[model samples]
Target: MNAIMVMELKKHVQDRGLLFWMLILPIIFTVLFIAMFTANTDDATRQQVILSIVPGYVVMFVFFIMISMVSAFIKDRDKGMTTRVASTPISPYFYLLGKWIPFMCIVIIQVIVLFLFGRLVYDVPLGQPIILLILSIFLTFTVTGVGLALAVIVRTENMGIAITQIVALGGAMLSGLWVPLEMMPDFMQAISRFLPQYWAHQAFQDAMAGNIVFTELMQTLLILFGIGIAGFVIAILRYPFFLKRAVH
Candidate 1:
């Protein structure tokens, strides 16, 4: 089961389209964001803007990473590969892990790439590299569960793509991706409170500020954890096995 899962993971990574979605798109967005924000800023303004963006970027980062991972699962289920996986010693959880491990690695790579680019090109201060690393890992794992649930529940690749985009875009914006929670409208802020992206962004914001307060960070982490758990439960309980049945 482990061997099959590993092979399957490798096969997914080797695919050009999957690789682009997992790694390249995030990198592209990171560069574009940094460029646009820093273009007209003074030294101080550049630093300020970059610092502000850290949290939102983290949210968008995890969101985009999920798109490829979920799509991989959709493609497998579409092609009967998921059924073959089920017949093997591998269980649904193992299959989930197989899809997760690679994308987590991609997220880590994206973090390093973006962090360095921000520092060198945008003059963004690199604050506590260790903490940033830990934050990135935590965010990646949390999103993996969400992606797994999305893949399991979505009936078609097209629908999966649509759902992920909607979730990603809406969640990010509501969670203060385009604007911080403090600055957003009251209704948007209220809505953001219910979404996992809000808590995830909160975590990044707290971490970037160097607050390092365990209790505060835990609130955000716990909220994201709760979301992941709920999604996983739904996916496990409601996961469809038959293509025809799943469609209707």
Candidate 2:
């Protein structure tokens, strides 16, 4: 598993496209939105805009990692790499873990780097350091777990890409990442409660505010953890079918 993880990490590092999507694009979106919306705003409003937009884009782009995960799995299947691994003595669980952990690590690093950029460049307040760290960890798990499930389920890379965009962008709109929930219709606000993105963005905003509402934060964490676990369970259950479709 460690060897697979190391090998995957090396490949991921060398992929400029992946890095661009993971890091550069999010920063671009953050800057663009901040510039567009914060113009002529006062300091308090500007700070609120920064707080919301930084975390909003972060949550949205993090889901784009699913595109890479789906491509990797499908490519391995088509190239017979998955078949070769299946023939080896390695357990399927370990194989999945090997594939998963690298992406998880990448996500952790991605979150840290983007947040640091927000702090240093945009003067975004990182309320409580410890809580922020914990939130990032859980957010990583939630995104990657869903990615793993989607990776195994999608038959084609393009199909995976399409679905990922829908999930990422659609969820962002509905969850109020692109706009505040207060501005949305009542129905839309109620629906936002069902999305992991909504909970995550809300929790992040709370942490950034430095108020630290324990009950609300705990509820958000539980929801994120549950979603992640559910995704992993689906991946494990569907993996056998995915393996069966691998080219020889």
Residue-pair clashes per candidate, as listed?
0, 0
Which parts of model 1 are misplaced by more than 4 Å? Answer: 240-248
User: Residues 30-136, candidate 1, lDDT per residue (tens digit)?
Assistant: 66776787797798776666666755775776677666766777777667777766767767665666666776676677666766666676556545566667667
Clashes of 2: 0
| Error in Å for residue 208 of model 1 | 2.8
lDDT of each: 0.68, 0.92
Backbone clash pairs for candidate 1 read none
Worst 10 residues of 2 by lDDT: 239-248
Sum up the clashes in candidate 1: 0
Per-candidate TM-scores read 0.84, 0.98
Q: Model 1 Cα displacement at 150 (Å)? A: 1.1
After superposition on all CA atoms, what RMSD does each candidate show versus the true structure?
2.8, 0.9
